[model samples]
Every structure is written in C-alpha cells, then in structure tokens.
Target: MLAVESRFTGASGLDAMGAAVADALVPQRLQTPDPHRFTASVTSVDLGSVQLVRASAPPMRSVRPVGSPARPDGAAFLLLGRGARGEIAGGGVSAPVDPDHLVLIPGDAAFEVTYPERVEVVFVALDAPGALRLGLAVSGPLRGLALPAAGRALLAPALDAVQAAAAAATPADVADLAEVVEGALGVAVRAAAEPVADPRAAVRAAALRLVDRHLRDPDLGPGWLAACLHLSPSTLHRAFRAGEETVAAMVRRRRVEAVARDLTGPAPGPGVSELAARYGFAGGSHLATAFRARYALSPAEYRARHGSAHHLRRS
Candidate 1:
C-alpha cells in the first residue's frame, strides 16, 4: 500500500518550506534573492519500497554540498520535469532541465539544481536493485540533453500514475506499480543513450538483452520493446522473425525457467505464490501449469524432488 506521510499546502516563509523539503527530500541549502516573497507547497509519500517528493515553488536554488550523507541504500532520485527550466550540476558536469525531458540524479554523490522561474517537479526515490532487476542502471547523472520523443512519451503514463495515486488514501498493490515505473525509467534511460546501428542482427541482439533483463516484467513484450527501441511494431517483428522463437514466446519461456531455478535453488526462499508474482505469473496456478508443461512436474513435486529443503532432509 502507499500512504501520504506529510504535506505542506502553503508555506509562506522559505525557512518553513525548507524544513518541509528537508524532511521529505534530503537535507539541502535552499536560497532565493527574496526569501520573504517565496511561496510553496510540498508533499511527501511513502510507497513501501519507494519514496516520492513533490514540490511547487517560485524561482530558487537548492544545493546538496559534498560530504553530505549518501542516500539510503537502493535509492535513486528521478526528477520529472514540469514547467521548470533550470541547470543541474553534479559530479563536475551540468545539464539543463526543460519541460520536455527527465533527469536522473543518483544520490550517491553531490548535486545541485537551480530553477529561475515558477517550477513544479516530482522527485521519485526508487531502489537501485529494483531497477537492476529489470536490467537497467543509469551510467551516471544525466540531464540537459534531450531524450528521444518516443522514450519521453513512454515514460509519461508511469509518472502520471504516481501523481494520480498520490491523492488516494491507500492504493492497492503499490509495490508492483512502483516496479513498473522503475522498469519504464530504465527503458527511458537506455533509449537516451547513444543510438545503436540499425541492422537486423543488431536489433535482435539489443532486443535479446532487453528481454533477458525484463523477463520478470509482465509488460515485457513486443509493444514495449518497440517503444523502447524506437522502432515500429512491424519492424521489430521482422528483426526477430529469423530467431528460434518470437519475442512473446521467449518472454514466457524465460520467465518459467527463472521460476524453476528459484524453486530448485539451494536457498529455500520465496514460496510458490511469491515466486509467481516475482516472475510475472498471474498466479500460483498459472505458474504451476506452466512449470508442469516445461518440467513435467508440479512446482511442489519439483521442490520435493530437487529443492534444497528436500536435499537437506535426505542428507
């Protein structure tokens, strides 16, 4: 579930607003030419595995100096731009934040962003492992440079969902929703990187990497891949046609194989239902049917025959 932890409807003074910002976001130095004239509203939410901070304010400068405490483990800040134009400098590089683009600022080091006009920005703090599980890590802090329009379009709905859910008292299955956003963020980051050569083999290779990384994502399929790679659906299909299996088949087969490995691993960990959800199965029954088809054994039977717990008992 997701819940709103704190909210500042309107804080007249910069100090008051700063206090709210620090409590929700990381501690930082906030300044403006006329502190008295400043007006702002901020809201912070705890989404179980993620944190979201939204701030609306007039022109200002915010800084997190060197030697500041590193962000909590697995945390990466995604600044989604909205009506804000500014410059962000971090790790000895600076980039502009315009309305058309998004910025990823990993909090493991120092960073700063200055906006010269009225600005509204949504900052999402997500787990690094969550993103890596979906096959993405931002190479470094990125801003200023324009991301592909198609990539930006793909990310819009995920961010919109988060903002819309902020008003609800408690949204169901929020962790899953958070992971979806993380996957979308990764796809956007990859899309923003240097373009790959447009060859059938290259497209197939790149698509394979994406498929392997996002096997656990329910949304990992042809439509999503086409958007991520900035190719038409027909073109994407043609690229994979000569392969052993279609993209859809690959996703299903890979997910089932991943679940089977988990079931038989030396560590007796997540149960059937948990594994099902983790690997993108609709439910335990769905996973059971798929597992039986692949290995000729129900998940429980497979575990009893080959799992770590079974081995331990035998020993």
Candidate 2:
C-alpha cells in the first residue's frame, strides 16, 4: 500500500482539499456552508486494483460522482466510522447511511453525499469495471448492505490486518495486497449478491489485470495471460470474446496508448526505440507503425507537435 496523507486548514483549506481530492480520489466539486470552520483531510493507500481511503471534514456538500463524466474511473464503497449523519442520492434512489452502515456508491452516476457535522468515512475504491466482475449491483444505488455475522467475522479482521500493514509495507507486500484483497472481497461480494455470477466478467478482468501488470514482458500472449489467471488459453479467449477486442488486440492497444502518452508528454521522455523495447515492441518501426494507425501521426511527428514546446521552454 502506497500511503498518501493530505490535510488542509484555515480560510482557504476546503478549496485546496477540493483540488487535491480531485486528483487523489475523484474529480468532483466540493463546498461547505462555512469555509472558515471546515477542515478537510484525506488519506489514501493505493493497493493496486483497489485503494483504501479515509476522508473527513467538519461538514461538506459534494457533486459529480466517480463514475460521472466529471470524475470517472473508480467506484466507491463507504463504511461510516464516526460523527456524522448523511444522505446519498443517486440514480433515482435515495438512502440514508449511518455510522454503523455501508453503501456502494456507483461510479458512473452523478450523486451527492451530504454530511451535517464532523464525520469520517472509510472508502474501499474499486476500478469501475472490477465492480462488475465482483457482481456488485452497480447499475444504480445499492445501500444498507452489511455483512452477516459470519461474513463480518471473516471481513473485519482481514481489513484491520491490511490497515495495520499499510503504513510500513514493502514493495512485495504491496504487490501481494491486491491478490489478498481480491480474494477476500470476492467472498464478501458473493455472500452479498448470492444469485448473480458473471464468471466471464471476472475472468475478463483478470486477463486485463495481467496485461497491465506485465506490459514490459516481451513474450506476453494469450498463453501467458491464461497461465497467470489460472485459466486455459481457450477459456481465456472465450471469456474475452464477449468484449470488443480479442486478447492480443487489447494488449496491443494498451501498449500503443501507453507509448503515445510517453511521447506526447511535456518532459523529454524516452526515445522511440527505447519506448518500443520497453513496451514489448519489436523495435522503433513497430511502435511507429501502430502509433500512426491509432493516432494518425507517426511517433516522431506526434512528439514534435506535442513535446517540442516543452523542449523550447527548457532551452
């Protein structure tokens, strides 16, 4: 877990925390009835596929949810901890969550969470797609779900262990935390949603995760992805067929997109040949050809147009 703690105070604190909140967690607008009295703080631990975030303030009003266009990418599950009364309204549903409750806040829906007084909440952040894999009822609002006594017995301690290990985690421990979380949450998600199971969606997400993590491995292929995901190659291909792209195609697209970002960024990033080899391309020409197909500009041309301004600034 990569721990990041940010705090703000005084007259301008809430505004500053808003920008920081947008970057670290979600892109949303925040307001407080009284700015001078509002102090906001958030601490996040990046645990790969999921993140753990603790957010607190005197009182707040927020708009634009994580899955909304204003701020999209991840979904949130909030477990209220202390000192607040709140209402969340989204996707034509309204629910009140007390300190003893938990709620799944869908990523794509525009919603508002209002707090009346000083309060703190723990959020387990999941990639919007992974939420689907876990069979979360994400099409709309899902609230007031708590673990059964037995389920809570299994979950609460696992999370507490993770939190205790968060501040002093080594790289290997952090890498393993995602697997630990996915396994534990997989059980919890199933216990909560008992009827619906999308094995294809789960397998598809696993393949995507493998591709993202092993992009630098030159021999990444369907076989490799299958092995890592504990599925046969045929099963892997079958699972991915439900999506728009085939397995190989998706891997290629992600690699090309990554190289394009590096080339088009402000800093004097790696050269084309280096970028190609680093991202599992055969060479610079291989990367240039694919980049052109995707962006309509060769790597060199794209770099010249987007990155030269930064070079000039540096000079």
Per-prediction RMSD in angstroms?
12.1, 9.4
lDDT of each: 0.69, 0.69
Model 2, residue 51: what's the lDDT?
A: 80
TM-score winner: 2
Locate the minimum summed-lDDT window of 10 residues in model 1.
130-139
Candidate 1 Cα outliers beyond 4 Å, as residue runs: 1-12, 134-145, 169-171, 194-315
For residues 46-124, write the lDDT of model 2, one tens digit per residue: 8866787778887777877545452232344545444577777777776665544456765556677788777777667
Q: Candidate 1 on 1-315: residue-level lDDT in tens? A: 354444333334677777776766677888876776677777676665567777788888998888787565334576776776888899878877765566666656578889999888877776544433334343355444356886678776776677567567356656666776677766776677733223555566556667777877778888998776667889878877877778777677878888777777776556778888898888888888988988899877787787876532221
TM-score of each: 0.55, 0.59
Candidate 2 pairs with clashing backbones: 67-107, 67-108
Task: Quote the positional error of residue 236 for candidate 2 in Å.
Answer: 3.7
